[model samples]
Target: MDGSAYGDIVAQPNWTRSTHDSKWAGYLKSSAPDNTSRRLAVYRGSPLYSRLDHHTMSRAQLLKLALPLVKTHGFTREALSRSVLYLPGTPHAEPLSETAISALFGDGDNARRTLLDAWLDDARTDMKSAPSPIMKDVLASRLRRNEPILRWLPEAFGLLISPPSGVPPLDPSPALKHVASIADEACHIVGDTSLGLSWYARRASVAAVYGAAELHQLASPATAYEFLESLLSSSSNIENTLVNTEAYAKYIGRSWAGIIKSSGVF
Candidate 1:
């Protein structure tokens, strides 16, 4: 369910606007005039439901579309409850509110990570299914993973603990090899040196060492050691805490351990 689906809707906008008298599920049915051009229509709209404009999909339609995804994505009341994806309840059970569902989904790392992996997989699948004969290039694959991780890991790992919803910040450790791997791969995908350079400049300014250098054990050991010495020097302030945070620690400790373990470099 994406651009193509929306395109089909837009190709024929025959949806009747919701009048909000009774909460009935909405729909879009296509009656092809010549198999090439069809008149598709939507029905049973609700005031409580939000409408998708690209192709006039009603809340009922969206919920139905999400049914399969929800089922595949561990359909706890969490996602639907938050309205991230609409899920409706009729005259029988108490509807789960957004706040309650969000609280549940954001409950713990295990839950969040499980959700994260699921999202990454979904995004990956959608991207791979692009109509433009999606390329399986390394960069595309990396970006698929990177975008989601950067968008979610900060909160999941408690990096950007109070980040805004949907666009979470990256609080990942600089030493995390996967961070460098993904970033590099994403940059390679865009094939734009300027953006890549800009990205490196931004990450390196505050980071003790950037992802790539640290991950492949290329951290200019001498330079990094010198920088660390300077960082640890006479800074009896919160500034000290900033440089030695979770991301940096994970990069140096866990990520390094992983790389070493993987390479049999023990």
Candidate 2:
């Protein structure tokens, strides 16, 4: 999923000691349960061997370059194309064409979803680094980052869940994944390391609160904080009742359905 288009520059004798050793170390560890050495050899033989430092960049790299442009271009393909212009070194002779953009990101709504996911991931990263480890403050910081692209978010949310004309609606897993990620990250930040049913409850409750708060922000930006606080006030009860995995899943589903309905994005 995170492969890069560019190939390696100079093949190193020791693959483990390559410049991207640190980056791939975790990958190697995770894949060690399988035949790690054989997999490593295959990757070394592959074109993407020098992916970390190459003339061309990965989609993740391109998206990172494109993120700042979202403020001006509102998550359009134009913003991604123009991202090449703002690359640290010399700019590309021309922007990426529609075909190239689609290939790099995806076709139709998938492209926008990819961009939205990248922005959300970046927001989570920012949230992780906040000075305050408090859940409320961390979530507030996460919501604040959305202000830059708030105008386009409702449309983004719709595209994330709605399919093209004549196509069936897509699963809202991506949106749900991001919400879970935010909830998980907030728990990690707040040092909530409980196991068992409580883990599921805490995450589900946080995700529900954040989902509602974010939608409330779209309608009433000024009072969203107050609304969030009110939701948080009752989160304990919500968590207690969501101990069952099925119940927690339903809670999250309802939260997201409400978000879609209230945003008029369905």
Candidate 3:
């Protein structure tokens, strides 16, 4: 991992003191030093880890650990509004609003677009006062890397898209139309779906190169936006395309639900 990337993961106050670290320490003390041993130790120690362990614990042990953590550390509106990150500007910092967080975590089709636009808008504003072209990209990169709820957005999106039990069936046309409109708007905001692809691909590639723990952060968004682009670019009739897309989307959505349920929100 690059120094800055590693710093991003460890920079938060008391991150080293998190329970995750304590568990790692315990595992290392009990196990021999080797590649497989190290990997097993880390995996066994991770709070995000999930598996069935009959003798030591039981099924869904990780879920049990995560549920209580979520309840205890749940995000608050005031706390979110107060969050800030340094950027290239006279003030050298940008404050993210609770509304932005809500929109990103909200159930609406436009939520992703809103979240991306807000971050890009701030980056553009910072770029105007930036001393160099490299600084502009730096600002944008930092914004994405340090984005609040980066770990939770996918789970939130998963929950949002999940079908609610007992809801009556309604016309699919309007919902499909709304999704199309949101896709157009997102493309407009970012210039094109190609640019969105580039943006996500860059993040994913960098994270992979750096061996970042949160690969899903990039994967989930890339999958979702690409799916949207595919829907728009398909030449098939709207009804047919919507039918197939809905099925595919539901499948992907269920995968995310399983991920969330297994891994829990961070």
Candidate 4:
């Protein structure tokens, strides 16, 4: 975990914490808006992770440090290596070996994937902190965060949907999970306390809308908010349809199972 090195970095100017033992952890907590902290408390799945050990803390700092380099280095190991220089007087400092980068972040695509997760999670949290209760405004806040790295988003998206095997036929789970998290945060922000099947349906609809709006944003950032509004307007129909279909499917499946059991087909 390089605990000693993390301690040294914590001692650096601009990172000292008078209130908490872990300076960097305190810094991260204080930096987020009060609303964000509340939302994070309600949804432990939110990106403001709680396990703040030296390893986790160091990686968080490293990702933040490396984010800017993405503009120049295109989410490559070179950027991560360069970011090490900023953490001077540490075991993770400059001349970062490939092994160190691999240890800090996994090797190959997984490492860049981690970087993408950090970027998206931060954006999602920022979206939750928007003052507006309107879903479209919240989504817009999130999409706008991409502007700084918009030029490279296609590559990031590619990394996101890319299969871990590095083969053709993209895996959508990573992207799906990302959107689902965004939807969950949005629902929390808007005070949507839906439960049962409705909870799943609501989040599914929000995720679908946000996902489409995000893709639209990539092509036409100027009109993305309008597209998001249109999607939101139609979401009720989609949610109703999904809920009915889901309910019907469950009923039919259970009835068939009951019939089969009664018939002693086995």
Candidate 5:
């Protein structure tokens, strides 16, 4: 098929590489498992094909032209997520709503710094008391989506654990204390983390809940609540024991709690 036809198919929100053959085989035959060859053929035929020449245009300029076409075609969140993970230097048709354009371009460098600062400020404000419930809910909501904060957590931890130049030194003890308080509150909502566990086990129970929520994004559109439910339902005795022992809560209390605590120098 020609570039226009291919572009039309790709523009659809639900379009996948598999969709090309299953849905639009009349225009193009399935040449390979992936539609890479077909996509290249279409690109070669499109007006933008000439612009691929590095000397002819800058990467930013190409993205400026291509983004409109991508949006016009109806780019989906699933496609954008995959592109962010798989296509590094390549320009995406659209940015993920939770991610900043600058962060996406720099692969979370800017985002990590921004979030770390925010977390520090928030933690300091609540150093003497538990973090506000509203703040906990806000964090939980962001963790559920494919947002920049979730994506940048590992890097943020890296910085917190071993701060680079100009990055301030941090003491994670206050953050841990706050996390423990939130976790204890969450336990009260679910069942009880203090029932049969030691003090360390109780702390670990809280850590587990936060860890589960942070990882929930990896399983996306499926929420952290659903994932926790599934884990609770697991047949394995150990799995069941962990959730039950921890008193798995409906909502993650302070999703960044365990992360901030665990990334300390100690």
Candidate 6:
């Protein structure tokens, strides 16, 4: 696997840290198939990943695989956001998306949008429990991107976030608004502001990226470049580091990619 894959794998929910490194070694041994490869191929005479491949993994599995990834590596909130953005459609994902979830999120979609938007609008918040380590030059690399993500707008941003799956298709932006409403109520249901903030920040970061990228759909090339340049140049201006990095990096990348309907400019 390449760096990105390795980075992602270590972050997978299946991974866990033991009190001893030997546990990891044992896991490595157990995960392996025969003497050929560690990759699990046929579980009970079928492709081991068949369910995951078909986007059939349940929500229980999704959370298990994804949460640990976030916690272990402290994966960026953007990464966390992406994970949740696609949760509704993930294989085996529970019916977490509910309308009663956010029915009280104001009357209109815009109001719901605003409610959802605020969950992670600020950068100072620590959105994820497992925070990714400060990657070498990742911040700088993001700031330096020649263009932001291809095409995105804040409203359409949810589409860019989440694991790739085909379980179901949703109108991601509205779904996000709904999800945010659900999330908001869920937090209140639990009565924890900090926990709510933590829950939404990562999810919001993912939307912000998609929303920012969606703007490219309306922006001219020069406009997009200038927007990205300004974002990068003004990093010091933003009080929040996480927000700034995400807006400039993952979101920007997604926005740049959105324009081309791909993942990146290259």
Name the candidate that leads on lDDT: 4
Report how far residue 126 has shifted in candidate 3, in Å. 12
lDDT of 3 by residue, 57-153 (tens): 2111211222222222322332232222211111215444556545433433333333332322222223323333332232333334324445554
* TM values, all candidates: 0.25, 0.69, 0.21, 0.69, 0.29, 0.21
User: Which lDDT values do the candidates have, in the order given?
Assistant: 0.35, 0.69, 0.35, 0.70, 0.40, 0.33
Off by over 4 Å in 3: 1-147, 162-182, 190-266
Cα lDDT of model 1 by residue, 1-266, tens digit = 34444444333212122222112222322111121111122232432224334224433233333233333343334434433233222222544464544454444343334344333333333333233331224323323333323433333335323233434454344224334433443334435354433455423332322233222223233353344334323232433354446458768898778888999877
lDDT tens digits, residue span 138-196, model 6: 22222222123223233334533421343354445444653343334323333434433
lDDT of 4 at 136: 76
Candidate 5, residues 1-266, lDDT tens digits: the string is 25544454334322222333233322222222245345445544655444334222222222222222222222222222333322223544654454533433323343333333334332322222333343344335434322433444454455544433434565555345445554554444444434444545554555555556655655463476566554433423554566565655423444556666788944
- Candidate 1 Cα outliers beyond 4 Å, as residue runs: 1-80, 89-107, 130-138, 141-266
State the displacement of the C-alpha of residue 36, model 2, in Å, after optimal TM-score superposition. Answer: 36
Q: Write the residue-wise lDDT of candidate 2 on 1-266 in tens digits.
A: 23331232122212233445324433332211124345445545555555444333335445656677777787788877776664433558888888988988777766776777667756776676566998888888888888878888888887767755525657677678768889998999899987877888899999999999999999988898888888988997777666665677989999999999999887
In each prediction, how many residue pairs overlap at the backbone (N, C-alpha, C within less than 3 A)?
A: 2, 1, 0, 0, 1, 40
Q: Candidate 2: lDDT of 78?
A: 84
Q: Which residue ranges in model 2 land beyond 4 Å of their true spot?
A: 1-51, 56-58, 163-167, 240-266
- Under the 3 Å rule for N, CA and C atoms, how many clashes does model 2 have? 1
